[model samples]
Target: MSEPPRRNDDALTLLAVLTDDASRAQVATITGELGDRLLLATTIEEALAHAAREPIDLALVDVGIDGGAGLALVHHIPALRHDARVVAVAHRADLAHGADALAVGADALHLLPLAGDTVASTLAAARSRRLDARERHALAAALAAAHTTRRLYDRAMSALAAGEVSSAAGLFLEGLVAGGLAEGLALYTALGGAAVRVAAIGSLSAAPEEAAALEALARPGGIDGAYAPLRRDGSLVGALLVSGARATSTSILDLATLIATEYAAQRRARAAMTNIDDVGPALTTEEAFLAANEHEIARARRHCRRLTALVLRGCGESSALAVRRELRSSDLVARLGPDELVLLLPETDTLGAATCRRRLERRLRGLARDEGRGPLLVTSGAATFPHAGDSLAALLRAARARATAGAPYVALDRAVHALPLGELVPTLARGTLAHFPSVAPLDVPFPGLLALAEQLCVEAQRAGLATYLATDHPGRNLRAPARSLSARDARDAAPTPEAGQRDVRPDRRAASAQGSSVELRGVAHLAGCADLLVIVLRGEHASWAASGRLANDRFVGVHTHDPRLADLLAERLEEGHRRRNPESSP
Candidate 1:
């Protein structure tokens, strides 16, 4: 009915060819309901021009135009627009002319001034044909592409089976060639602490940090034309970065998955063997964790004991050891990878897990201090049983998504109510490691957010804390000079972009020395390293879960309405810092 309301951004274009004044008037009466969607062309030349520039869906041609040369136009419509449907019309009903129109590839031949019912039925049939033709063409193209991909994929699989391919990189290159790509291809492999280039065909190169960021985006699923993560057993090991004009095909993604799976199986086989001799009774393997988690989940279901799963990423082996030492003997611990760990906390509720997290944060911070490194930046997320998930894999996925979303802790508690905006700031200080300021439905203005950030930065500096005020706003109209904010001296504070400056660093890591508060823009790479990261969720870019994954400490959320909110936030942060390091109090 009425063209199904035009289907959001997919309005159809109809070209009406009426050479005479009388014909124009009659055509207008039939298509007046379509309004601007109908394009009127007086001549065949004008009709062809419209077809060339716009995607014409349907065309109404009167063969009586240009001394009946319109019959010739009917033959050329297929060349002009293969997808467009044509309805040939005449001033009066002439069976001979209608027969000729039908012979010349016209979908329908109608006589003008006919009954409204006849016109509607004839046009409906033409539109149906147009749609059916489009679907057929699309299906044919997709089938052809799939056939080509399958052929290439089969060859790659054959090579692997025949021992012709040796490395993961080589397999990846084969995938690219299968996808009809020979240039501008790069492959990055996640090697524990960082991402390394595994293979390259063209001059394209992505930095280690860029590769890491790309891998993060690919975890849930690969984005088109960007990168695809190589996952095995539901964990990310590396990613394939696609650049330039070559879009990633489904076959390419499947090939990457196969390669990753092969690699992981080999590694796990070796690890499983070594664990029998090397692993102590205190810690377990991923296989053990799976069995134990399922068993505990069943026990919890029967006895009603609470269970929680915590996943930690980017933490080194030392951190993992420290975590094992701190955990109770009853707790189940397992290694996810070289830099990842999973802990199953039995007989623990969300609140208990949270308290444990805070204590561990303090201990880890102290450990980092002793090691003379920035606080061990660990991105962790926890999910509870029954509420978060019923199975181990589901729970792990939920936690990983929350962790990736930058949420400090995500509870699958379907019953809990979100805190109000007014109390969110305070609750953030007490419970969460990172806070996203609550805003109303009416979005806050950009200037208000900048003002709030400035206030927070000033307070941070006054408290003897190095502050970084990073903004991803496109303009260079910051409060300070628009240049890199690298520290010049140990005690030097993080710099700010000067007003009226033209430089804009879309992704910059601005850090202060001891008690550093690094500011970051769109830099997902620096998020894990920041002692405190302040994110201003403005407009549609607001994604709080992603922000939590970046900050090492709990982030603070502020509102534009409260001018005094920043001062209170800074005071609470300082108080918390002092409480953590009471022995260092001056």
Candidate 2:
């Protein structure tokens, strides 16, 4: 009937150690029971040699190989088959060595006085790790996947632009599967605020009214799964829902969950873009774009003209804030890098995109000249769709091409990506085009916050006061605040950060410390400062510091503890404010 299923080539190939026939029998017995393949080696050197020649997925190291040296000899296992999952063999007295074995990457350690059950389980775990090893066919699959992704991405863009959300979702789901997960895939959508299974596969038992159940689950109560709402600017389009699968590890699940979440955002975006095409009984520009490539859209890659890469630079804090102002929940924009982002503009072609690029460049240049500040470069470029081969790589390659072109920004084509909007946001921000908290925005004079920020920094630098400006996220993830406050004080904190929400300057806050503030990512980049002694508050309330379990402030009688950011917050805020004032005459 059907062709035999491909072996899970990713399966573990086991290597067992032994001297006498008894251990060999145990090895064969365990391997057979585990349904794993085996390779035999009598001595440690022999095992190492065999493993080096081919990929040995797991190693059952005989710690007492020559009837001695338990933990010491196990070190050879890691040296030989470095990536192999190991299970250490030990004498009953060597049971303590099990902990040591595991620390060295041994999946599990088995006692010499082994029970059949313990041996099997350890082998099974090794098998699991082997199968899940992110390195297995990762490189190859990743490479092969690289090709289809661009086409898929273009397809996604096309579908979204044409208002074919369902189709675009299919592209996303399939592309994600190709990206890694062997498991079947599905897509969920936000219908009336609830993330429902708009599409799916591999769903095993009966799902209980998934749409309605999911809607209920999204509310205030009910198991209350954390909703990391996906927001572009500040609009809540839909949430990225993650369901737990007991089959995978937490790390694996989280990564998979995020990937799944991205599909949701892309699908929503595609749907939004496509709708311009479907509005009935009207001669619409959206319909024209859709109609141009009607047959070719179905043909997939053939109809698409050029696939261009857009590289948006100078988008630090100020740039991000400006972009955010332009983006709405209904219009999806995903952050691909700290300062780089991808906007899937559907159907708009390249020639047209170039015109749009020029328009944007003119505006930015005008602003830069008017402000008499730093040069702002946002450039874009195009690589023909199939010619560039339409994937993330293709897009990236296209983007890389334009990077050296001396343009601040570039676009492939306007019509290919930009669906003619009924009405675009009049401008990113209003009244004087002042810089927001993003790195850089329109630099015309406005009510200045930068002056205050500058003053604070001068005061701090003059007094040699260490300052640290607190950020909501982008920087929050960059710097994890040191926790010195107790649980109750943190939990009862009030005056929820309203006034602090108004971002002043662009991304100018930087963490300067003689201390150990520099972390895994590097120095914190934002507006603010910190020192040992500092004052803190929320809105008009003067937050008092806590001393030995005694909180000294009452906020409108709510009695909340000072925020964890208490120490240098006032200075950080003031520094950030000073940076926003154009009149400060930097």
Candidate 3:
């Protein structure tokens, strides 16, 4: 019996991995009669190569090929082509051979002197099974996509319900991007008579002004690429701008409407709350402070602004009042405990917070003297956003730790230890290079420092850590030449290379050849020590800094795990760079 010929699209492609001439000829004849394609492979490599290039519907394996190696190919065929069926062809019907074939993922076992009718029936059944498997696989993918979409929606809604409108917008944009609805999205709220972007995700090239103009002109009915207007009670409250080939304007519009409604309700509720004025300057309640802190943190993250959280212990009402008076009206002051106060300073980096702490300490000391009290010991600690910590809890914990320790910088200085340049370079590079950003001594005459710095830069780039390299020797190349170096040359050049340092040189070459994302800034001069090299790495989860000044071939500067120290050094380096190159872009 002969099977009917299949149409062009329905035709199956069969792979026959056989050493037997008879079996190969039989497979070719069967495929020819069935109107299907047959690929002949004598080795496993050839069969895999054929499957890699094109789809294979079924595979026939000669169990005796290469002394049983062909059986292993049956396991791999299905992996390469998910729906490909395998049949083991044995010289004779042996129970052991049949069991071995079935154990290795063969769909069926066929004995030599194969019948054409049996082969045709097996091919038809395999085709049916392949089609069913493909359908099931597609259905599973669709279900997974739907589940992901629903999860993202629930998370965004939860943020919205928590009164975090900016966070909600960010979460929603992330969800849309994750769900393939948009490549980029920006959420704009009507603020101070213009559309202001509150949150953004992915690659959006539209300028703030352009986004605002687009929001102003956006209408209810627009194309998939156009802005979606957010309206509440017929009044336009905000807008959503999405960019991508897969952008769904209708879904975005509905989400915008829901967000706008919730936002309007929140605004009305806030307006209805009664405002109370205190007779004297006082700290804000912890609850109110936390709420405001969260809002400020969200704004800071959105705008790429800096924020500082300071914790001061051993402060009385008089000292608290002094702190409140010393701070700007925009700063937030709240009592965290009976004698501890927390201050939120927006647009403040570590250095700014340190300066504020010094000023406040002086004011408190004078107040204590005037009140005829003993020397007031007010210990304070400060942590900056995107540096010391990203969240309130993290920032508070860092700040509290610093306050408990005497002076922040003094404590950091105490932690610093002197080490040989050879030892220090590898120690810093190998240990916590990824966990913390680093600052190294760059002014050292040692050539190894430059190589180590370059190696660290490459490692940081590979690890996805944002790196900043500053040096007084701007003329020196930070990266090694893009060529293979001998083991002796590497050792002589670096003295103490990091573990697997040789393996990562290719990454360095690629990074340099590709134009590394690591920021390199050269100043004509550096404050403190011209030989000082500062390596700072900033990451979402952690920050690290190592600043070393070479003295008598020894690195004798501070290295701290404290992110504030790293941030402070980074800020100073940036400031120095700006002073040296006034017109250059940062």
Candidate 4:
């Protein structure tokens, strides 16, 4: 039976790849039939180059046109040109003949010498009716992209509304990363009240001086107009500064600031309302495979199990550090922000993890000591793998939400509508966070750290660590925290985890406890245009307690009572829940 007709709403801009003059003319003739949507490419490379610059909704490749060059173009078109869909066009029904094109990457097949009218008609019909088997395909991709963006935005806002800063930051950063803007972007903001570069993606290795120049780009009324008005309730917060020339305009900065402000506001609102804890992220459960061969990718698959994801944002750094330190000291963790975090809960679904999140958040709020501003704010989202989706990118996108712009949202799942994802979409492999479970350590010790005369942990070099050791360590580390590393990047010295390949999940295996532990995490001098320590708890009681009081002059430390266990717990907490929700015990 012939396939049904393609639809009109498909809105695909077709790239017709053909070498034969007659075929090209025929397809050309029918271009108008499909809204003159065809863009002819005699060669594959030209088609790809065209696609890179503009949107090509669909690609039609002539299978017998050349030395598999047409087929090759089909494969590359879908990849390089994300918005471009692909299909194989040939004279016969022998799919085997078109198998190569299909094998590499072909979304649909078409028998050749078909009337140009017929081709256009088929594509048109496909676009209109979901019931037609031969319908060329649906606008699944566009819908998905839009949906993912929306879902991510909503969850982000939920996290933001809840005042989960880093979690919201993580959700937002994911957008920059997926949009391919990371490599050239810089995330600058007010950690508490002072301005600082919170996170950065991309390479500035050779352009340190150039990168340094953009630092001032976030200044108020100093050529950086975007950040000039980042005030909520008459208070100026920090700005998100971008590096490189692509987004170097005041407009871009304006857009960035708008996004950041919306995000910040949503976060503040979410936190004030919930007062109850929140939760989710990915999973981690391959204990056996991890134990057998930590680095053996294939083997780990067998030992892994199911896990969910919890993202917490908007609480900003101080609270996020406390939460991450608290959770990692006890459970699974991944740091998504100086203030945001993700939790990979093994053996639990998103809903289950959310339950735990609620309880935990409630307890955390209970622990809140009033500073008069309000209970710390936090927003959150949850997503699962395989069941939710097979691609890490897709899953994160689908279940996450951003509160920065578009319509306001409260939760992730609420923002997304998972309709049928029709054919023509990319193949997604089921990968696990198991490969890169936790973040690399941001575990930097204070320079020349020593026991001060006052018995506080102080920087031996400047006596600052000693003061910082007193419950508050302020003066942002001009350097990135030591634990600020990628997954594998963080585990250079980790013993092969006893987790299995199948056990690949987020923070499933907690460090074996040696004894009681305590953990503290926070940013310092956040008010008065400086960073502030939110919490300081850990096995190293004296150190953490001391750090809390030395705010702005010292870096906060979260520790437990047991030295070794304390170290393990404290260090682990820093990596949990995307480095947002830290915890400890004593």
Model 1 TM-score, all chains together: 0.34
Per-residue lDDT tens digits for candidate 3, residues 204-233, read 535253234435546565323456677767
For all candidates in order, the CA lDDT equals: 0.52, 0.42, 0.62, 0.42
C-alpha RMSD of candidate 4:
28.0
Each candidate structure's TM-score, on Cα atoms with residue i matched to residue i, is: 0.34, 0.27, 0.40, 0.24
Q: Which candidate's TM-score is highest?
A: 3
| Residue 378 in model 3: lDDT | 75
What candidate 2 gets wrong by more than 4 Å, as runs, is 1-11, 33-35, 66-83, 95-99, 131-586
Error of 2 at 228 (Å): 39
lDDT of 4 by residue, 1-586 (tens): 0112343654445677766567677766666555546677776667767778766666778776655556677767777776555778776644554787777777667777656665676556545433342333345644555566566666555444333445555565455444434344445544334344434444421222122333356546543223233444555544554433333436434434544554444334333323313232222222321222221111112224334555666554345445654453213444444445555554443334444455445445544444344453555665655465444344445445521221132231122112111100000011111221121212223431222211222221121111111112334332122122111233332344332222222432222111112223432222221232222222111223211212334433322222222222233224332233334322
Considering every candidate listed, which one attains the maximal lDDT?
A: 3
Candidates 3 and 4 compared by lDDT, better number: 3
Q: Candidate 3: TM-score? A: 0.40
Decide which is better by lDDT, 1 or 4: 1
Clashes, model 2: 68
